[model samples]
Target: MDADLLKTFLAVIRQGSFVGAAEQVGRTQSAVSQQIQRLEGLVGGPLLVRTSRAIRLTVAGERFVEYAQRLVDLADEAKRAVHGLAVQRTLRVGIVEDLAGFALAEILRRLHDEAPSLQLEIHSASTRELLPLLGFRYDVVIGMKPLASRGGVELSRLSLCWLGEWQGGPVPLALHPDGCGMRQAAIQALDAAGIDWRAAIVADGILPNIAIVRAGLAVTVLADALCPADLPRSQGLPALQPLSLRLFAHEEADRQATETLGRIISETLGAAVC
Candidate 1:
């Protein structure tokens, strides 16, 4: 069995469509369909039942999933064993600014402990800025969900909270510049509630927004875990929805390394909330 075909098959399972799998695998939809056909031929049976709405795996496909994953994992492990020491593989990671604080610290610490040989290049930006670079500049991206339409694994969901002192008038908000998920959420929530708001400080990153909030200039929305203990969660404002943290990986990225990083991030954030 070809490992590449197995990988494509796994991507199809994960993405739930041939078009999505094609994007992940850097192949055309027709190519992905042909790969699946070829794989089915090799396995001597049909693996997937494709309908107009979704793809369903056959019993044979269900049975093949485990072995296929194991074979791919072993292949990846073998490659790492052969070239890890001699070739310093660089893993480029992109993350939202909100997690660039303690959550990121813990993630990096665990990643270093687990995959010490990996050379990492980390970029922290707004989710809007990071998603476009997923397969191009970044091997993996940790971003806020509902922003991406498809193709990311959910890591955790953090409740959004209003952080800072409430001044009691049209709410003064220190929000990120446009293209931020939180910013969009905040504005929509405020508008839907008929609450008047003024963007007191429009910054590109979280730190600047935090600085403004700390100075008592404006209130901002943040994940409950990211809010400072000293900052009060203002009441009487409309409740905000929880933001889902998601991990997106390039199809050709080192699978084990990306999975390890995703697990560490999920655990670190989960522990923080707990």
Candidate 2:
């Protein structure tokens, strides 16, 4: 169908007069009338019945009007698609606090340059929390695989290790609450060796654990992917077998190529943390 005819018909309906629609569309009243006439002829039915005092749509007109509105909306969306291809509007991203050590800052920086208009909402939580929320909560999430979740798949995997202040005595350990994979791995290692240790502190967030470790408060086991640059490390093999944590991304409609995002994360981990 001719979009101009649809436009003219819609304008006439909205403005309530051909003369008014002509003005609204920047066309002569006769041109508007011609467009309407062409549209009525195509439909093979009367679209409108007009009187000097009033104008209104027929049953056919109302149905066609609905379709006309959809066509106009599609046209507008087509225009927006060009701009959207260049930059997404807002990307909702969520990651567990642990993975933030390596991948968090990297993806954020690349998104800034490649999609400047994108509004990133970063949510940090546990792997268990982050995984299921990917169904509706976020566009991307980087964290350990959730045990029961079948939604997201791994982007990459890295070894987990126990690191602490070398000078710190007997390595008073700080740990997050139980049920966490990291904590489970650490304790299993300690138990098998029959190692004696003291629990000096417990923190809810990974950042706090990092802070405590950096401040020499206590030692903690963390993913090798997260060794930060600012804190110096002692050169030695981890006491326990290294664990592996897989980074995952949300999978749903319109999942895009994540190479750029992956590279940013890998490079950032390389620079800021080992």
Model 1: lDDT of residue 104:
74
Please give the distance, in angstroms, between residue 198's alpha carbon in candidate 1 and its true position after superposition. 1.1
Q: How well is each residue in 185-232 modelled by candidate 1, as lDDT tens digits?
A: 889899999999998999888888888888888999988887667877
The residue pairs that clash in candidate 1, if any, are: none
**Per-residue accuracy of model 2 over 1-26 as CA lDDT, tens digit each:** 87778889999999999999999999
Which residue pairs come into collision in candidate 2? none
lDDT of each: 0.87, 0.69
TM-score of 1: 0.65
